[model samples]
Target: MENLEKAIAEIKQALPGLTLLEQEPLAAHCSFRIGGPARALAVPQDVSSLARICSILKEHQLAPFLLGNGTNILFPDEGLQELFLISTEKLQKLFLLPDGAIYAEAGVSLSRLASFAQQNGLQGLEFASGIPGSVGGGVFINAGAYGGELKDVIESVVCLYAPDQGLYELSKEQCAFSYRKSYFSTHGGCMILSAVFRLQPGDREEIAAKMRELNEKRRAKQPLELPSAGSTFKRPEGHFAGALIEQAGLKGFTVGGAQVSEKHAGFVVNVGGATSHDVYDLMLHVRKTVYENSGVVLEPEVIILAPDYKLEDKGPRVHGNIVTVNGPAEE
Candidate 1:
């Protein structure tokens, strides 16, 4: 904690113009409306400022956590006193490349990207219209729904690799996308800056219609009205998480103020005044029950950040000589 305090002080002195929110409550930033205060959360205006902040933290042998749209996250009520968070909310650069592909920054929401694609008569992004995460978060977890994933449309990604404070661009194959994950998901030191999406041309009206149809389906099936992280658990290989949960007779079950949604078994909504302990305990019970009922294990889709949650530094990977960030890079 002392190290974190010193690092925070250094970051403030280094970037005087940065918007650093100290002791900010995590609840207001996330979709669940649950979570205690984070020690320090910095919002950098652009990728350069973000990189500088990371470089400062690295100097202190400390690492920072990047908070995206805060959709699929469960931050504990006890708070993160030892952690420094960097929010991508201000990295809102979205445009089209000269080569007819869409360019979006880390903070650009998936819905907005899909809308932009539609307005430009581009297809293939309609499936992401209702996903409540930003481009960075979507790419982190190869987020998909209704038979579509970001990996399918993403052409390339640019990121700042923290270990060396250098920038690198990775192709779709290098991203190593898989079900609900990407290389960036498992690898540390890589902070997503932006991405270029390759999409096909289609009728503007038809694209809009498709997006509307998908959003309507989402609204009907998801517990959007309630305060909850989208889905509590990932889909098990041979079966759906919701189906197995329902089959185990755990639907609509409550622990404190947290309950498996009566509307959608997949969601664990905060009925009212739910604490993080309540949520953690409830999810534990659900996992144990589901595993006992069906021989399958359920993995949480939500990124739970308890007071003790810490990510081990996995060092870094070598990004080839295509671009030397410190030498000559975009950001």
Candidate 2:
């Protein structure tokens, strides 16, 4: 605690005008609305401020967690006391280039980005219209919906690589984007600053129609009214996580305030006042049940941030692969 206080003091001196809060509740930052308090939370106003804050933390030998919109993360009930939490919420600068490409800061929401593209007659980002995360977080995990993903439109990224406290521009191929994974996922201590998206010109009416269609599909299928970290588990190879849970008869299963969404088996929602422990326990139970029934171990899609948290399963366990279900999996 003494070291933390000293570091905070140094940060305040180094970066004036930066928003700093002590013992801020994580629930207020995350979409799930369930977590304990963070020791210290810092909000950077822009890329330069973010870089300065990162440098200060590095100088003090402190590793601060870079938080985006916090849509797909689970913070522990005990809270984040070990690391300073840095949020990109205020760094939301966006503009369009003359060449028809869009440039957006990390903190810009995906929905806003898509809307911006639509307003300018750019077509490719319609799939992101309903995603509830910042551009940085979306790109970090290759966030996608309705068959389109961040990799599809990303032209380049400006990132603050923490190892050297240097900024570097990485091309699309360099991002190494795959299904719900990216270079950021494997590389620790790197912060995404902004990204340039190369989108093609299209009719404004057509783009808006597409976005509206996708949003309706999302609203129809997802439990948007409830608080969730979106999908609980990644889609297992050759199967969907929701279908597996449904097949295993685990839909609507509850552990404390956390319950599998009856409306959509893919989500584990905080019915009301759910704790991180409850969500974690429910996730474990769901995984075990699905594995026991189908012989395929489901991997979590949600990023769980808890002290000493580790996956109980070593990896996916496939036992004598065979058809366990009668028909094709449902979305």
Candidate 3:
């Protein structure tokens, strides 16, 4: 407790202007709307401010979690007492380059990016129109939908590598994007600052039409009305996770307020007042049941976090008829 207080005090002293929220409720930040209060949360206004905050956290040996819009993560019900959260939501900046590319900060929402692309008459970003995450989170998990992905249009990414506290630019290839995976997944220390997306000139009307079409599809299939992380499981190899769950007779399955959406088996929605433990237990049940029904193991796509949480064994754990696959699925 003393160390935590010291760290918080030092952070405020170093970055006087940085926005600080003490004992901030994390549920207010995440899309799932389920989580306890965080010890301290920092919202950096810009990239330079984010860098300074990161440096200070590092100097204090405090490893903060970098949050981007919080659309695809699950915060523990017990809350994060030790880890300070740094939200990039305020770092939003977007513009079109004269050469027909879009430059966006990590905090820029995918929706905004898609709109910006349409405004500039740029194509190739229509697929991300309804994605609820910020650009940084999108690139982190190589977010994709409607047959388009960040890897398809990204030219380069500006990252703040935490090891040296230095900024570096990585080309699209260097991003190591592959099937909802990226270099950021393995290297948790690096922070994405901004990205330059290479897009082609196209008809604005056509782009709008495409976005509308995709959004309609999303609305029809997804349980958008409920509070839930977008997709609960990654598309398993050669099989869709949703289909597998449906086949396993797990649709509409409930564990407290958390339930596998009958509207979309791929999603686990919080009906009302769901706790993080509810969601986590439901995920474990889904994975185990799906694995038992079919030989294939299902892995969670939602980024789950708690201060003392540790990755369990990846191999199947047999308990009665349920077989749990503890490995991470593709984002």
Instruction: Give stretches of model 1 more than 4 Å off.
Output: 307-331
- Model 2, 1-331: lDDT tens digits are 5666778898899887889988999999998899899988999787887788778777777666778999998888888777788899998889998887999999999999999999998889999999999999998889999899999999999899876898999999999998888887766766899999999889999999999999999999999999999998888889999999999999899999999999999999999999988998898888788888999888777877755444445233322111111111111
> Where does the lowest 10-residue lDDT sum fall in candidate 2?
321-330
lDDT by residue for model 3 (201-309), tens: 8999999999999999999999999999899888889999999999999999999999999999999999999998788778888888899899888766778774344
After superposing all C-alphas onto the true structure, candidate 1 shows an RMSD in angstroms of: 6.8
lDDT of 1 by residue, 118-143 (tens): 99999999999999999998998888
* All models, RMSD in angstroms: 6.8, 6.5, 4.0
Better of 1 and 3 by TM-score: 3
Off by over 4 Å in 3: 1-3, 309-331
Clashing pairs in 1: none
State how far residue 251 of model 1 sits from its true place (Å).
Answer: 1.1
Off by over 4 Å in 2: 310-331
List lDDT for all candidates, in order.
0.85, 0.85, 0.84
Candidate 1 matches the true fold with a TM-score of 0.92
